[model samples]
Target chain A: MDNKLSEICKQLDQLALDILKLCEEQVKCRVKLEEAMKPGFVHIAKSRYIMGNRTVCSLQLPTEDSAEFDALTTVVPQESITDSEHRGFKLVETPKGQDTSGKSVLRRRKEKPESDASTEAKEENVKTYVDPIKWFGVLVPQNLKMAQNCFQSVLPLVVECANVQGELQRVQMKYQKLLKEKELLS
Target chain B: MAIHSAIKGKLISVIGDEDTCVGFLLGGVGEINKNRQPNFLVVDKHTSVGEIEECFKRFVKRDDIDIILINQNIAEMVRHCIESHTQPIPAVLEIPSKDHPYDASKDSILRRAKGMFNPEDMK
Candidate 1:
């Protein structure tokens, strides 16, 4: 019981640190974004039509990581506990040396069995990657491009922040459960 | 049908003021699904709280969206709706707008995390 409580405490401490780092990164990203925006506002304000009514970007959800990085919870069996009794569970993450490359998180083409004509058409639609800036008129100002770059770079950070927040929540729930159990035992 | 969508990637949606929407959309996270629904909403003073809540709820229910970015000040108005969502897939990130700076204390996820530990221990 004591060991379990201490483990929970340690996990909480690590998650606290992760949140702090994420917050700092967010601040930095905001600064870069504002810098990118500062030079463009005057131009963008004048040409309001550049803010088109429709979006040209396509949706491509990142593929889930393999089983190891999957956020699924698994019960960690304790020898002393019977199968019917409640047992502790832990959320597994990729161990060291198996870090996921954020760039590679983009979804791969879907595999499907179809006629030759349909397959070719689907492949054409999926394979073509259009530059989103083209949605705006050609020869947009440099600041708008800079803002786009800033947002693209910050995309990975946003994903990382979300992952950390989810993990923190999971760990916090576990910590609360252990606290309850410790009280019952005492 | 399930197999088709399962293999496809997800999208990042945005609900923010005009500047924030235009900036991120320019970054290429925008999309209009098969249903002719655009993935973003550009909020202004004319936008109602009810409309914002509805858009947020729609985004939460969509299978394609992986992330939802809302301007922090706009999120302040719809705090209850954002807090009610607990799913891990469609992450709700409150971002800074041109007019309002990011406030950690007002952020739902950040504040929850801050509450978990004492300030001294974090150091």
Candidate 2:
């Protein structure tokens, strides 16, 4: 049919586009890989970049030339040390001399060891508020209702697919029967 | 048993010589889609390697097809694509045809499995 032909043409067009994209991607990746495998790249593969083990490809190793190198020191310059100190917060002066005591000791009133009433209140709150089992029971019914609704929505589509599969099985049976008949006739 | 049940919902696609194709089709592996493209491709001497490669690519992309069986020789024509395919689902299998016997050394999947077992291959 014309519809079938057109559909095939459309599929062919899509397939062609997919193949084009895949080939382009393959070429891009391959070119990138080839570029990386070249002599100058990080991994200097001996097989591709060399002829003989005795003969070195690059006369000099990648190490920095001593001619370009100079001796270095661990000594911190006085100016840099001063710069480091300056980078920190401006030192705050104590509010107009209440007490300039070097040791401004902080001491608190010893905490109330525990009021039995507060302890009992905490125990009561724990017992009343945080019964996990009770919370689970409350949420279960609502979750079950949601799950049932979800299953109800999905069931029709599942049934339709099953029906189509059953139809396909019937067609397959018929095809098998025809083949059997042909075998007998032959 | 699991594979049997799984395959019942999914179709097997084939690409092979005419005789090989006919044998599988008779075994009830052949299917035509709504768009009128067959799940099986029959490759004759006249069939180009490019066409075989295209059909192989199409079969790999089809979600409905779960397994692909190609003639070992025919598979060689599209070896690059087959080796590149890493997905376990829609597994690609190379089978021998009348003209060409199966070569264990050349089969990519078999070679991969062998490599897995060989300790030196790990290096």
lDDT of 1 by residue, B1-123 (tens): 343323445667889887777666655566554455777788888899999999999999988677788989999999999889876657787777778877767978767656766554333
Provide i-RMS per model in Å. 11.9, 32.7
Checking candidate 1 for backbone clashes, the offending pairs are: A60-B9, A60-B10, A61-B9, A61-B10
User: What overall lDDT goes with each candidate model?
Assistant: 0.58, 0.43
Worst 10 residues of 2 chain A by lDDT: A68-77
lDDT by residue (A1-186, candidate 1, tens digit) is 787766656665665556567656655655554555554444444444464433221222111221112111111212224455322222221222322323224434444465598766764454223344554656765645766666655555555555555555555565556555645644
CAPRI-style docking class of model 1 based on DockQ:
incorrect
B26-117, model 2: which lDDT tens digit per residue?
Answer: 32334444455667777877899899888888888988665677777988888998989765545566666656755656666445433432
Could you give candidate 2's per-residue lDDT for residues A82-177 as a string of tens digits? 454211111111122222111112211345466698775653332111111121133333332332233223222222322222232333334345
**TM-score of every prediction relative to native:** 0.63, 0.37
| Candidate 2 TM-score, true structure as reference | 0.37
